[model samples]
Target: MAGLLAAMTVSLTGTRVSAIALPWFVLTTTGSPAQTGVVAFAEMAPYVLVKALAGPLVDRVGPRRISWVGDVVSATAAGTVVLLHALDLLPLGALVTLVAVVGAARGPGDLAKEIMIPEAAERGRVPLERATGLMGVTERLAQTAGPAAGGAMVALLGPLAGLAISVTCFALGSMIVAWALPRGMGHSAPAQEAPEAGQKGQEAGQEGYWRRFGQGFTFLRGEPLLLSVVVMVGITNLLDAAFSQVLVFVWARESGHDAAVVGLNSSVAGATAVGGSLVAAAVAHRMRRRPVFFVAFLLAGPTRFLVLAVDAPVWAMVTVFAVGGFAAGFLNPILGAISYERVPRHLLGRVNALRDSLAWAGIPLGGLVGGAAVVAAGLTPVLLAGGAAYALTTSLTGLRPEWRQLDRPRRTGPSVVPAPRERAGTTDGGRAERSP
Candidate 1:
């Protein structure tokens, strides 16, 4: 468990750092917001598609292997970018291609780490919510540290230096997963289930890849609450991608600030988020999920955009971001717990993959839309529009009947619950339990 978390932290930190370095590099070099958006799209389009496809593979081959291999590929791609640039051979086209490779590899790598979390929690004897909160902390810590370091690197040395650091971090993450984890950990789903179910499980193992993928999709389609959450999160993620990839960078440049200020904004939010994650880790299990989720969304979503849209003072902007970050901290743990509680263990990889892919599907277009909007109407108007949309989406989504199930108690054993339209069964030890 410790090894997994450590590996995740290192990898995520590198990704976050690159997020700063790559966009800044593109914007400065091209001096075109549209090109910046294209770069972002080049990366995320492959990320979403590959991730959606990689779920069955992750389950079939084992997450540990997929994780390490993906990291290695990502490291190579990042290193290529640095090497080519230093050699004066890197073009915008090449840079976009390399980042696309990184994104493609990153999809499975991140999903593998996420798929391992429930097992890690079980091994550590931690409750699901706390474990997810800890995972959130790990992410928040990366967000806090990565941007700080990237900003410094970009300011002092160059953006290339930051990219170089990303290469090193990816390599280290690969090594950690390859060598640090215990043998037999993160085994294939079939191997893990075979002993318990004997021949029946082995038969299921023989199912084709597309069949397995279809099952995950079918299962996800049947869950109304999960579907609603996915849709809402998808919209928010799109806005966030725009905010981070284009709007904020443009805001900083237009406001006569540097990359350091950008880093500072993210780092402050991340720092406070760590505190929020810690608190959630300690007590979220005892809290009502619906209110907390909605409240957190309210604080986290619209405020950052509105603050920037108004061209607030740096101090004021930072303060709002800090508050928003803290609120955002409580979100993932609750969502993760709910999803983990609902999905059966054997289906974790595919189900989570589909869920995450759907939620992230809009991200590839966020930068494109933001860049075009900025070109058409400028930053402030776009920010205001995004903020209003965020506020409305989050606020109105809570009224749905399905969201009320957010507070459902965690089951003691595996959730063998069938989809809504499936046949309901008695509460026997091994039957298909009904969805709410």
Candidate 2:
């Protein structure tokens, strides 16, 4: 678990450093905000596209292998960028292409790591929720560290130095994955079993990649509770992107606060969020999933926009955002645990890839949509509408019948493993079988 988590944090830190450095590099080089946006888009589009398409490949080839290759690709690309810049050979087109490659490789690498978490938790004999909380902490720490390191490196040494740091991080991540983890830890069992391997070969011969992808869709479609969670979370993610990208900046600027105010508010919120994840890790097993999920969403989702709608004082806004980020911290651990518990071990890679891609689809367009809406309808109206939508998405969606499944207690005692008969009815490969 430590090995995997370390690898993830390092890789994620590299990615986040790139997020900061790449924009600054582009802006300084071209002196065009338009080119910066284009570079950003170039990276993210390939990321989403590759992730959505890589599920079956991950399932077939194994996540450990994919993760290793992904890191290598990213490291090579980042290193090449550094070399090209030093040689004065990196044109805008080449830079964009390299960034796109890094993004494309990172997407599956991330998904592959995600697919390994449940098994890692089981091996560690820790509860899934706690394990996920730890995973969240790793991510939060990376998010906090990456930008600060990136900015300092860029300012003191230059953007090439930042890219060089990114390359080092990626290489270190790859080394950890290659040397630290046990052999075949993240690979599927069927790949090693002769009979299962034969069966897989037969299936592959019969069904194409699209068919395998469609199988994930079919599984998710039959599970209404999961569907509800995905759609609701997807909408919230869209709202969050908008808030982070456009609304908050506008509010800070219009309210006569400097960028430092925004940074301070975000730093407080992020710190509290880390604390919340640690708390969740400690007490999650004792808590009921449904109420915790609902309350977290209620506090975290709509409240920020609502607070901004009234144009509250900086202190009030900071307090609201801190509380909201803290509440939000609990959300992912619960969701991640539920997802792992419900999905079958064999299908984890494909299903998680597809589900995550769908949920994340709205992120790229969010800033564009928010800016357009602010232009057409103005900021206050947008905030109010976003707040209302978030409330409706969470509150109204929670009333649906399928959400009751979330209330099922964590299976305890010696009979943690389900019998074959008990597992027959499950659609999504989970231990608990669901009746259609």
Candidate 3:
């Protein structure tokens, strides 16, 4: 558990740092928002697609191995970018391709880590909400530290230096996962019963790639609550991608600030977010999830964009982001708990991958749409529209009947169909566990 959390923190920090460096690099080099959006698309498109497909493989191959391989690939790709840039051989096309590779590798790598969380919590004898909240804290810490480091590095050393840091962090993450985690910690899912003698070959063939993939999709389709969450989150993720990948950078440039200011804003939010996460971790299990989820969304979304839209002072902007970040902190712990409770253990990898992929499907298009919208409409108008849309989406979605399930009692076993010969009362070690 210690090793997993540590690796997650290091790897995620690097990712957040690169998030800043890569976009700044593209924006500065091309001086085109459209080009910047294209670069973002190149990375996220492969990320979403590969993550969606890699679910069955992760379950079959074991998350430990996949995580190690994925981090190594990410490190190599990021290093190549730094090397090419240093040699003055890095073209826009090449940069896009390299980032795409990073994104593709990151997909399964991140999902593997996510799959390990419930097990880690069980091992540590922690409650589900607290464990997930701790994971949220780890992420918030990365968000806080990564942006501050990346901003300073970009301002003082340039974007390539930040990319170099990303390479180092990825390498370190791979090493931690390889050598530090306990034995049998992330092994493949338990095997099902043997096929009947007469139908052995046919059954074996049916258990191949597509069948495994379809099982996850079918399970997800049956869960109205999960599906509703996915759809709403998908829209918000698209808006967030646009806000982070394009609008924020553009705002910084227009306001005559450097990457340092961007870092400061994010870091402040992240720092405050850590406190929120900690509080959530300690008490979220005792509270009703529905109200907390909606309230958090209300405070976290819309306000940030609306503040920027009004051309508020830097102090005001900082305040809004800080408050919003604090509210945002409660979100993941609740969501993670619900997901882990609802999905069967055997389907963790595939089902989680599909859920995440569906929610993030809009991310690839976010930058594209935001850039084009800004080009056609202008920043202020786009910001206003984004805020309004965020408010409406989050608010209207809460009224649906499916959302009442947010506070459902924890299940003793999988909510969906169990595997052949699996017992009804048995769970991960006969104890109910959650994830983040």
Candidate 4:
């Protein structure tokens, strides 16, 4: 499990690099943050929408196959972008279309990876907390390594060329998944050779594609904790969406600097996040979850706003991002573990989809909202709003009864009276009893 995750981490580093490079490239090339934001929205919108739709597909096709397909698609898409750029015909519309495809593919890939953790571990080789911790660590490592690598790659080869490396990494990761997996009719469907009656009967037992798809919605509606968490998270995410894309380039423009300077800021955030991921891996299980969630949320908002509020030195902004990234690092694993532990495995896809969809639900609005925010009060006010929203949402949610207590083991069934033993099954000594 660790090996798979570690290998996959390399692929994610490619993704991380692209995240930095793509926005910087878009903003610089167009000289418009709004356009940069449009690229972000196009990518993220499909990601959010398709991820929700694709979750059940992961469960159905089984994680390994879905993962491979997603990776391959993403790799191909990335390579296409590179090709377009090399040809010098990479229009903004074309870029948006390509990124949207990548986002769509990534939805399945990410979902499959998340589902595989519990499945790969099976009964007891890996515990949820520990596995999730390691996942956090993997992500952190990517965060730390990705930006600098991306920056260096872009510097040496240019942004379009960087995609070639990313494509290679993703393809390699997919190959790793393709070859290594346990097989035997995964995804809980009837064998293809089943009799007609058996097939009909099975169809009744399991939902068709459309029916199964709708169940994702039903599942979310049935669960209160899931709904609450997603809603609050969605709120904060909306606030974040407003500034996440244009941060570095906007900052550089505001400070009268260059694109390279923007990369430096992104690299700092990635570095700090890596440290936080390691810490999360080490201490996640020992820590009570509620407090951790609350405190992290509380810290994230203010740190984000503060970074934008003051016209401090570059290092000062970097410091703020470091703090914010640290807080951000702890969130996903904690929430993922929560979902894993509490939600039933069969419904994991829909649940994940619902949560992810909600979290990303605010993304489309980012371009419009971010543009407005930048125009009205400058980056500082926008950052401040994001921060305040982050803190306020977390604090309020912490007061909920369900989230107040840390997660623990759950009872599986109602208690029943114990049946009397049959004369102790057999007497062994002076207190011997007759057998039936």
- Per-residue accuracy of model 1 over 228-320 as CA lDDT, tens digit each: 878888888888878987999999999888877877788788899899889999999899988998898889879999998888998998999
User: What is the lDDT for 42 in model 1?
Assistant: 84
Q: Between the candidate structures 1 and 4, which one is better when assessed by lDDT?
A: 1
Whole-model Cα lDDT of every candidate shown, in order: 0.81, 0.77, 0.80, 0.65
lDDT of 2 by residue, 342-393 (tens): 7666566666777777777778888998999999999999999999998998
Residue by residue across 1-436, what tens digits does model 3's lDDT show? Answer: 7899899988988898898798888888789977987897888788879989998888777788899999999999999999998899999889989999999999899888887888889899989889888888888888778877887899999888888899999999999998998868877654322223336534433467787788778777777777777888888878887997788888888777776777667777778889888999999999998999889888887998998888788899899989988888888888788778877765778888888888877766788899999999999999999999999998999998878777874463532234333222111000011111
Per-residue alpha-carbon lDDT of candidate 4 for residues 1-436, written as tens digits (9 for 90 to 100): 7546855686787787787678877877889988987897787778768987886676566667777888899999989888888789899989999999988987778776776666555533776666776677676677667777787888887776666777887888787776655553135322221224455536533656666666656656655566677777766666665665554357568878787655666566666766766777678778887778668766655576666666677778777777867776667667767666655555566557666776666656755687777778777667667667667777777777656434653311112111212211000000000000
Clash tally for model 2: 0
Looking at model 2, report the run of 10 residues with the lowest lDDT sum.
427-436
Ranking by TM-score: 2, 1, 3, 4
Clashing pairs in 1: none
Candidate 2 deviant stretches above 4 angstroms: 192-207, 409-436
The Cα RMSD of model 2 versus the native structure comes to: 5.0
Candidate achieving the largest TM-score: 2
**Candidate 2: what lDDT?**
0.77
CA-only RMSD, every prediction? 5.3, 5.0, 5.2, 11.5
Q: Is candidate 1 or candidate 3 better by lDDT?
A: 1
Model 3 residue 381 CA deviation (Å) reads: 4.6
